[model samples]
Target chain A: MKNNKTDFIQGNIACVEGAIVAGCKFFAGYPITPASEIAEHMSERMFQVNGTFIQTEDELSSIAAVVGSSWAGAKAMTATSGPGISLMQENIGLAIATETPLVIVDVQRGGPSTGSPSISLQGDTIQVKYGSQGEYQVISIAPSSPQEMFDYTIWAFNIAEKFRTPVFVMADVMVGHMREQVEYPEDYNELEIFDRKILDDPDSTEGRFLSTEVAPMPIFGNGFKANVTGSTHDEFGWRNVSDPKVMDNFIKKLTNKILNNKSEIIRTEKEYMEDAEVVLLSYGSVSRAALETVHTAREKEIKVGSYRLVTVWPFPEKEISKMSENVEKIIVLENNLGQIYPYVRSAVDGKAEVELLSPSVLGEFFEPNYILNKIKEAK
Target chain B: MLKDIEHPLQKYIRPGTNYTTCPGCGNGILAQSTLRAIKNLELDFDNIVFVSGIGCAGWIPSPSFNTDVLHVTHGRAIAYATGVKLTNPKLKVVVFSGDGDLSAIGGNHFIHAARRNIDLTVICVNNRIYGMTSGQAAPTTPKNSKTTTTPYGNMENTFDLSDLAKSAGATFVARWTTYHARQLTKSIAKAIDKKGFSFIEAISQCPVHYGKVIGMRNDAPSMMKEFKSKSIHINKIDSLSNESSDDKIIVGELVNENEKAELTDLMQSLRTEVGTDG
Candidate 1:
């Protein structure tokens, strides 16, 4: 099973396979719709790999446990949907402030609150970015297919470890449950894996996690007298709420660490955009329909192309602007009621007229026929 | 002369570490008792991790311990400590928390951790009120006590935390007040050495907050004298059925059992059964 083989498995299972290959040693998750399979597979898989898995009492404990495990020097992760994300946001902020590297897979179901559990929607794109309070940034990767689910999870872990921050895989029910071919690699050890920098010198005060270039984690149980906290702190990890200077540096260093490295972090896909009039922009499962519409429009001699966002956050602002420059209009296609349209529109910055095209019925993925008709109307 | 003489346990404290507690706050007392127990147990600082949630008690080990410490979010210390202990079972993880933190917001994590019988020691400083945010009534606030929130006297009975730990399947349960300093240190040592879930409810005083609300003199001696007077030893169980003993603090070890398997060892046995033993 470690060698190369093709298996038709659900998108959620692909995530389990991906995490295991990425050196994830601990998983703590509560069962939720569409995301339960990830936890189910991890429960069995972790033992085989000599890892730890726990079905925690709730989402809060699941995320808290993941953070704890990560600090104790294990690659850790958890899976949940919209409601679970809501519960886990507090500890998510803790993970952010303490600079703990962990992965969270959000298999988004429709929701303002526990909306369709069995259905799929891209409702949590901005939620993943802003749900955790405070002035900090995150890396989120959206996967459009089961194969991408397997591949992007590894990328998510690598990005999380490299930056020493929480990374999210913005999965949805469609990609989570839909069975497709996933390729297990020939040698799991051959995959690119990134680990967080550990403090080589235990006596140095410099590895206290305040650098703009990131700092090595003074992980627990290794004799480093590390002070881990969610409060505003100086380089020593001691709470320093009164100092104006400490607050300024903490916010800027944390935010800029990701912003400075956005180039290496962001990934986008462009197709047939060299000569185009209209472009369909989307991410995750809705992109499947958008790509189909582009192919269908090409047969009819319509100069329409498609742009997809692989890395949903760090926004791909420049790429979106570039895509919009050569096109007449850019239609932001998504499953929900334009959750990502504002970001896409702002990125376009009026280079072209931007419009939002959602599924005819929410929770149902966009239909290519519906999109093509919209392209015909817009043109 | 007292300041010139270095404390024997000063090596375990971070240099220049200040207790920062108020004159009458018993947090310092419990803090010393915990450290004293660890020092006597001869555990290396490198092998122990202390997790404390948000409260006055949460400040016990954070920024003070020469050992690794996590001053985590309110109500989540037990959950986070679970991750640390289960991930590396060799590390002795201790959660130093307050009644308001462990019994209110983190109550679920406490119960479940005890239920799972994980190999961790938890020291709960039950100050009977929310001292950090001034004096609000807590789940452990004494019945009919006046608190900041309970202006008309508390309408609710307090949670018997030691009894709750016993019922929730903790393998070791002990209760003491700051007045019982020697016994508290001894119990902490015993709890640390215990295999499964070990909980120590250190009933302490908040002289500035809970003390004033209870109509006592605003001083540590006042509270200590009251603790010495009102507490009944666990050996006096026959008095528990009497109405007069209802309000008495039962101070001593309540439960110590070794029948169930500790979680880390259980996990190891699971690996053995799965044929993935390493």
Candidate 2:
């Protein structure tokens, strides 16, 4: 915890508080269900902190404004749901391509097309990873509780600023709406915040884009005369659309910047994984239920542990795959229909039998008894 | 023999022009007029950020403006520029895009930006068609004027973008053709100087697909000549309703008012009033 000072607040409000602590000076969003309180609270908080806030005409403009403010050297963000995220995919791609540092807080809701508005559905787990066009990698975090919601948001901004890329905090409906006590810094100065590395000597020949190491950002209005375009460009930010070599380098750098730093970016919390024969794996709100299952199964002398992913994307394949050697079975749990199951299965390979334990009901959390019964039934 | 001296505007031009417009494209004319506006007003490139969307007109600022420029995705220039302006009020943000990029897919952003009365100088080059996409019908395309998307002649009425801006609460609104180069330069300079949202619709000549579709000589000079004869100034018009008539293109400053509060200044004021230490 950053500070012992704690306040009981909603998950969405925790997120807004974390953002304000992270020194986010600009926010633009269109309010949607399960996440509307974020914008509602953020509007008042922004004025309190002297930050700019805009309730955009639509989701596309929301993301667009965030991207624009990021370039203008502001720590900018937007909050929306699955439906709003869908509208923002194209601009998200634009942000990725331009290497803009910003945060997108998607309070995950159920949907292929406007699914349950107020339900806890982890439907957007995979969508956030692969929603944007083209080949790109983005940092994503799935906070399990309101406490994690507050903590992980600051984490998201650090990764975004360090790598100069868009990061998503995919908090689901239950995690977003549930009220809980969250510890935060009383003095904003006590909070840890990171700013993107700036290109100090723009007159030098070195360009802004580098392959493996994160390149310094030449933010707008800084007199860098930097030309940034969504079209394929070289390190100098000059347009080079036709050259395949430039295009190859562009995509490679965009993804490798995050992938190379995966060790620090990927976060997971584990309990009793060393002695467990059966493992319960989940993220976001379902992880709470997984924790309960671990407690109940332990009472029966059955070896079971809970594995919660705090940072989901740049998926922690290596750590889990290594753990799979000890576990007999890894039971994946989610409120939706096994969205992350395939990735887990592929990561586990043949070391452990991996299967998804989707909730019997679409929106409800899995009861501890149901999970333990399913684990026993597989016996 | 040519004199051994540099062109006055050469200092503002950037290095790359390999992806530039056709020899007779009006974007070239409007590009200089824009640069000239910045020069005439003595604005520094360091303090100005040019944002443009996808189109030939969008290229005016990207590689040519010799300043910080953001060439964004199609139809979102206004939204991006809004962010830039609101974030740093010291930096003058200019959005240079085309008719198709502004009034078609970007219509909502264009109108809403006007409604907010943000401090951004938006110059929409109205070439009557989607020039970069090979003359598809655009929202600003004249009704019954044939285009690739409307080969049988466009059935929809065209948008008078200046009228839309005037009604949508833009503090400054003006319409000018590329032929009115001097006035176009002055309007752009004045718009940039204005406090709130300013829109300048530059009626450019697209002599390729648009020229062939509407029966022209297929040259910039001929289309530009037509612009000179078929134009009527707003000052000469007796009634506002007839300015949108098909027979003539209305030109000159339509509206220039700065009484409304600007978005960036308002944000700054709100931040000051509430304080930043919360």
Candidate 3:
């Protein structure tokens, strides 16, 4: 028998429920606006689920603790908005270099610097991908509603574990604070949980970071006696900063683990694209407006479609390129000043003209009329 | 070539790895003292995880100690160690780092870890300068001391790290210099034996930059002599006048109360009270 339960809940609270369902037993975070509810919910809910939640001193420690807990053989996560994410970049790079499986939920507010803590803005689309100071690939999911917040958070953890890398759930203020109905499974066991691949031969003496597929992680206390470092290292996790081959092979494998597996990692939602002349490309909360714009534009005989990005980091290039070939124009809508627009334009690559509709400031979401006007212009 | 007789603590050192420190550097003594403490306690080598931050002292544990080691980013060793300890309370977690890494950049973690009374031993080597970066003024550097960054003289007052730990509610807090190797080792052993957050400040020498700039001895021996002359044991602090005692380096155990509960144990009790089993 299928057990169904639906509850009206805040998106951030749903995120906590989703993380617990996904077996996130350790949560280390510092409270930041637009993202504090996630930590607050986790603090109260974690103990009930036999999990651990630590409110760290700051964002740096939060991510660091998450990384450490992940290595200690637990599913760990941390959530923060823009400024906190900026402070966490150094450790985020460490997580990437170490190939630690953890989830970072960026409940993006406004910024280049604390632009608007209470307002909703999708300003960190590019930052989540390239915020850290090195060459690496990141996996980010953009959820458009409260239901998707619960669903995609689980997806974020599973993907983080599957690929053995840090994954981001890019949410914003509107979706985070907005209360809505979310359907959840009665038994969390029914939800899919992806456990990280562990080393079969811990004492093999071979390189731990083998450049073949996803490398198996060794827990700290499992007698593997693994030496983990953030510096450039060889396969066995020993520092070898001088060797060019070691650096090249190590970095290439780190990137290829995600890029090579793009098909399985990338996720998107497409609507009414069969014969539409213009498509509205958006993600997160802005996608809600795009969805309405598509319906309203079609009523006025404007052959417009909607493409919502679920996985924003890998950029859904294949789908965008395919859509561009069929569509006359693409209108990209975001909450910030042209963060994801360039990516859409690059993906469309002049096959179809790409127009951007971004709010001039931080606090406001896009009105349907604004997106409909862009659809009209594109048409 | 036949090997020389192995030192008693040679078993603790990682094979084929050499200490990466300047000659006459006090980090070597600090590392040896730490190993001696662990040896004295006879801790299960397999269960000991040495976590370090980004600094000269951070290198003291990793690639040197034959144990599970995590060399983390700058100033986050305690934070990382907090996670390790909480995840597996049975694992003996130790944070080994320097002054700038701990008190300067990682100050918040130090205070909060102590405030929560988390179960971990933090051994911070206070060389009074950022020796790895050719000696910048550190948080533990004496006020008005000269360094590469503070060529005009450091105007900011330095932190008394042990006092800071005591005030922050650390269950065990002690201070010792590299010259007091035996005392330092014994203090570390007692700290490890304590159940809550433990902090040991090892005032050490960076002869090259710190010594040369401060007009102290340019060699480890002379620096040790200077420390010996300036040091006053905790028991004798009352014998000296208040004016004279203000400038003296009082070295001994300052706090050793175990009434406060450890964070992990408290968390466990909370779990039990909430009727959840882990």
Candidate 4:
């Protein structure tokens, strides 16, 4: 039975297919509204691909299991909303400190604390990057449509393995529940895959944490005598809290691994920015509204362009800064009050006027006219 | 070449690793018993992984054992080990943690893992107090016991871990004191052989913190004597008087049934049923 390559699917369903296609074999999650569909879909599909799906007791165990599965040589992931992500912060820090590769899909809902379960909001943008304590670099991707939800999820897993860090696919309720057409590849092997580097000689794992770049992961029961801990340690994965220099060198390597390679980690999409005077900056589901605003404003000779942030973390400052130089004003659009607006303002560095068109209330999207009004006002 | 005659299982100990445990701590004995169990089962060293949580007991596995070890965050070893087991069911996963790590902070994970009947062995070293952070009352701390955190004496009740495990659906549940090294080792071996969630709670001695406050002698031998006096075997539970049974530390295997399906096995069967096995 030959089926059409393109199928009308929900964004969360597309995410599940992307994960399975990307070789994700372990999923542990606690169901939450808007994000529960991802878990439901994974539960139905995971075992079909010989994968494991566990509905953990809570978000903490979900992420902890994902981290464990990753170290056990399985690509793992979990999905949740804002409040769930908040509960997972500690283990997320553990994953980062231990350099475990896994994926976390934060289907963005509203709130500081369970504010709105079914509403669409980008409030978790900053939380995803800075939610966990301590200084560290993270990779977070935003998907605007169902197609990007599928494609970026696979990219998130590849980058998670490539850098040996937890990657976040920041999807919002709008995209998560939105039904749209998605094109599935005939074969998953056609996509780029990045597996963690493993040491051939297990004996060489001694002093393992010393390497600054991505360290070769050693699986348990692999005769590596691998010792993995979340505490600050030397290269051998032993706790070394006494020495200041050990902590310094260890933390530096962790942050620099992504920050120094921002060129490869950061991505953005731009439309009609070549000669626009006013540019709308957005990400996640808000980008869809920005795109519509761009089309509507351009029809009115408003000279408005849109720059969608494909990668939210590591800030994409370079691209935004360069765009800031060409535009007379930059209007940041988000579903939250103004989380990413400050970053855009800082990136612009007074090169152009920065305005925020954030719909602070839950369960609402900024209509094209609202953003067009902002663009005209900025002009 | 004159080589000192060491214990037969000394080779299983990681080379050049020194004990981080305090003197008179029973964690070393538990570690040795774990290794002895693995040795008796003739399990390949390459096929075993030791997971530990944050505490004195958590250090029992990692730098000391030659096997692969993961020293995860406080109270999360079981959850982490679940991932390891489900990802590769061939691996023999064992978790070593303390009362505070397992029952106090990680109580939710402990019960849920048991309820799911995951295939893994969890060896909980119950010392009645949190030894790693000085003396602090733990979930297994006996009522009215004194510790740094409970200078006025603890008012809370303690958990009977084996009962908790049994009620939570563990297929194999047992409790033993550090003095019952032989029995503890045999129980561990049996747990390793069990196909579902297995829990062994070792009533380890924390003489430095817990014993000193409780008026017991602050030495390993004295603690062992106390355990011998207070312990009762499970087979004799019906013979003991109610008053004596209340104070006795029940020892021996309490549950060894495996009727319920294991988590990993169920997942694999589901995959096979769906024809998704690769």
Candidate 5:
């Protein structure tokens, strides 16, 4: 155990600290159980750092305010639980449509709406991706522990800034409120920060007019006349609501921008996919249990491997597809009712069998023996 | 799609079109007042941002002004305006919303923005009744007036526009009926010139909707006549007492001349104080 001052922190606490270290200067969020601590800790730390903390009227405004702050050129973020995350969906779509880089922390609790606040669940994995209207790719990170949470949050901001897209730190109640020792980076200034690429052409007045596939976003105070809109738009930021070509181009460019950069955003951990017939897939804090089970099963001479998803959004479909070729069956363990299972099952396309283990159905988590039994059943 | 981003307002209003209010209807006069203010301030034509919510008043900025205008979601003009302003604080942002749009559905954002003292001008066209939705009883609708939503006498008390602004933390709050054309123009100019959040509530007329519902003709002349007769202007604090006639409606600068630290100035000051800590 680390000392009290330099001791292990909860995943949520680490998320807050990570954002602070990442130079996030603005935070706007509403207080919801299981996620309120993020806001509370942020409020105090932000004040100390002379950063901005706005307790918005609701989750919608919370996200909207962060968007506003981000446009103001501050690295900004917001945190919420299930219902609050639902309210933020429209603004999330707005963020995507506007190409404003912002990070959102969704501390999952059991819920369709205000389900169990105290319990831990990973039900929002699919919701975080598909809850918003429209077709778009998203970047989400699942942290398995406090240290992982701290590290991934920094990664989330970097990805958001680099790609100019919203990033998600999908965590749950147990990881959020839990306390554990966390090591701080010795020199935070040495950490790399990614800022959006600004237009540099001096002679071309047409440079600011983005007719290209991916429109480059201009900083607000910069002299460029950038029009940010939610409506389907042309490159100049004008509302091209009537044009299908504009809509198609807008969607195509946005999709391609993230898709083409898959090598940069895709992250996963492959334990024993080399020679395993049974593979257990998990994310967030639940991956710890899965890893433990995988090691225990290995002791009994069972060829079981565990694959942990660090970035859940751009889905990691390629890695899963590759693993599906050799693995006879894939068992997915999460804290929710099979949210990511469909993606795993679809990724393999019946090339390998898929099974789901949800805490809502079974319990908080599967014990090592229980996971081994599930793996045995897969055989 | 328009090739050039002309203010929808300038493109929509035709020379001989009577689609707008009567010549004297407060909407036309308020529209003129807005243009006059914008011109007097000599705001950069391309950088001026006009955002309007849903209402007849909301349409005022769409077709007539040759500037950057956003026809945003209903009661969400402020939300969009905040985005525009924060995106480029140098860009002049003005929100054009109706009484119902600002006071009812957009009430939360209204008070919250004012409380923060964000630097922008919010021109609220308070016609007493909801004109676009056809004379529904609005938040600013006078009690006991007949409208589509209130066939019987209205039971709910109406909101006082100036009072609401004062309490909401606006550095400058003023009210003038469309009948007070010069006064309305001057108030708008001052509001625009103010460094902090400023609000100018223009009481206009809804002849086709609220007027007809309460036995007035849909004609523009009669509506203008009603507005002029009922309009009252307050030049001083005691102007209310001098013109305390129930038959006449109150107008003029209700609250004027106060300044607070604008949001950006405060942030910059904090940045300076914190220096490297920031």
Candidate 6:
């Protein structure tokens, strides 16, 4: 810990700084509580760097503006809470269907409406995956601390640009607003910046081939005629509402690009799970508490371990299934009411005992005693 | 502006039978004026992107135009238009949608884009009723207008487009009626030439939907006469005497000829500030 260089920063500020280091050049967002700090950080940094920051009138415009900025050859992003995220769903659908590269940070708070502003909750897990009208796969990440907020934001933009789809940094009030020490990399020179894919020859007919989902991307201002549309489209970006083959190919490739690459996208961390009887599965802010609980249990000789999920959207099913295969039991913990618990319990398949722990909105975190008691029960 | 008149769009309309407009509809006038403005401005045909959302007015960007047209999801024209404009900042981005599409469902985008003053021309057709959905109450519908949903008169107050734009930080805002085709056409041309967010609210007639309810669907020529008579300048909004019974005022050019920093300009400034570290 002393060897690593650490600078204290809030979770949202770290996210903004991380995006800048990751080469994010455009930010469009509406100011929402608990998440407004992301916009505020962007507002100041956008002026400090060669990036664009815009405060839209609402969440719809915020996401729309980011979509526009992304098309302009910038790594664009936006941040919002529950209500703003709801407003952004349609545009998010458009981004997914059109294969636009963007990063949306949803700093969730308690509510279906304007719930607790300062409080935290993980209620948007299902919505983040399936909130849009159609069935589209998404890449989502859950950062458990300020450091992860910074690191994961960089990874989020990289994945978005690589896959040419919208990626989610699904954080909550706890990790979004929390202040903690985050260490910057020793050599910042190693981070790879992924720019918008470009057409090599603007004049060649091959340049037009960049319109398809799997085709090479044509960057804007490259003097190419690349027509893009949100409708069911062909490789040429022309509307093909009547062609089933075109629809099938477009949807297949759009979903396949991310689905086939899940191994590379899915990331997880495991700690002392090989011989432990009880394993805790957690993500976002709850993982931090689970880590502490596991440490306490380890000292007490209860043989408890933890599995922390960094990338949560594809749900890290393969990693969890592999990690928990030998464990005697698994306990899932979160701030929302069983939002992700069912997935965890179903994955373990009764070979090991499965349980859930969801904290109420009363405070910042759950008591370590509660988690310790659950681990004892699992034994 | 004769030297500015362009082709493609100007040459698209065929001399044939009326297609689908209602018998006394004002959409024809709005579409015709838009066409005339495109011709008058001599805008590049290939670079002209006409974006529309789901509504009766959304059809304007469909078969009606020869240039690139994007018919997107409901209340999302502005979003797609932003995409188009940002990708090719040199392109002329024109958005056409109904009052409900822009002010009601799309109001969040409407005000935000206006506030940012993005360099896009938004031509909103305020027909006072949702025509495609049949007679439903719209954002601009009069409070007393009876519609399918509001059989007992609309209790919600109508949205005043000009006022909303002014408060939301639009650089240019204007209102024109279908009967003011020539003026509306010139206004549209001016908006296209302006370098910031320009909005033109074209008050239209929804005859099949609203006409049968208000008993105003007689002759198409007579409907034009009413539009010509009732339309007034927005500046006289305050000076108009309350004594007149014919007080349904359709004002024109509420706010015009103003300049502000565009979103691109702001981004450029930010880039300068962020410097080499980025």
- Output the number of the lDDT-best candidate: 1
DockQ of every predicted complex: 0.72, 0.73, 0.58, 0.69, 0.24, 0.30
True contacts kept of each: 0.79, 0.88, 0.64, 0.83, 0.12, 0.38
**Higher-ranked by DockQ: 2 or 4:** 2
The structural similarity of chain B in model 2 to the true chain B, as TM-score, is 0.95
TM-score of each: 0.98, 0.97, 0.96, 0.97, 0.85, 0.84
Evaluated at residue A115, the lDDT of candidate 3 is: 83
Docking class of 4: medium
Give a tens-digit lDDT track for model 1, residues A298-324. Answer: 999999888888888878888788777
Which residue runs does candidate 6 get wrong by more than 4 Å? A1-6, A198-254, A299-302, A359-364, A367-369, B1-32, B45-50, B62-73, B79-91, B108-118, B153-157, B166-169, B216-222, B229-254, B259-278
Q: What are the TM values for chain B, all candidates?
A: 0.96, 0.95, 0.96, 0.96, 0.84, 0.88
Candidate 4's displacement at residue B31, Å, is 0.8
lDDT of 4 by residue, A37-97 (tens): 9999889888888889999999989999998899889999999999999999989999998
| Native-referenced TM-scores of chain A, all candidate models | 0.98, 0.97, 0.96, 0.96, 0.94, 0.93
Q: What i-RMS does each candidate reach, in Å?
A: 1.8, 2.0, 2.4, 2.2, 4.9, 4.5
> In model 3, what is the error at residue A183, expressed in angstroms?
1.2
Candidate 3 pairs with clashing backbones = A208-A235
Q: What is the C-alpha lDDT of each candidate?
A: 0.90, 0.88, 0.87, 0.88, 0.76, 0.78
Candidate 3 regions exceeding 4 Å error are A1-4, A210-212, A359-362, B1-4, B216-218, B276-278
RMSD of 5: 5.0
User: What CAPRI grade goes to candidate 1?
Assistant: medium
Rate residue A266 of model 6 by lDDT.
Answer: 90
Q: Model 6, A329: alpha-carbon shift in Å?
A: 1.2
* Candidate 1 residue-wise lDDT, B1-278, digit = tens: 87799887788888767779877889888888988998999989889999999999999988898889998889999999999999999999999999999999999999999999998899999989999999999999988888889989999977999999999999999999999999999999999988899999998988889888777746889889889998999898785778879768889999999798899898877766663422
Cα lDDT over the full model 3:
0.87
Better of 3 and 6 by TM-score: 3
Q: What is the interface root-mean-square deviation of candidate 2?
A: 2.0
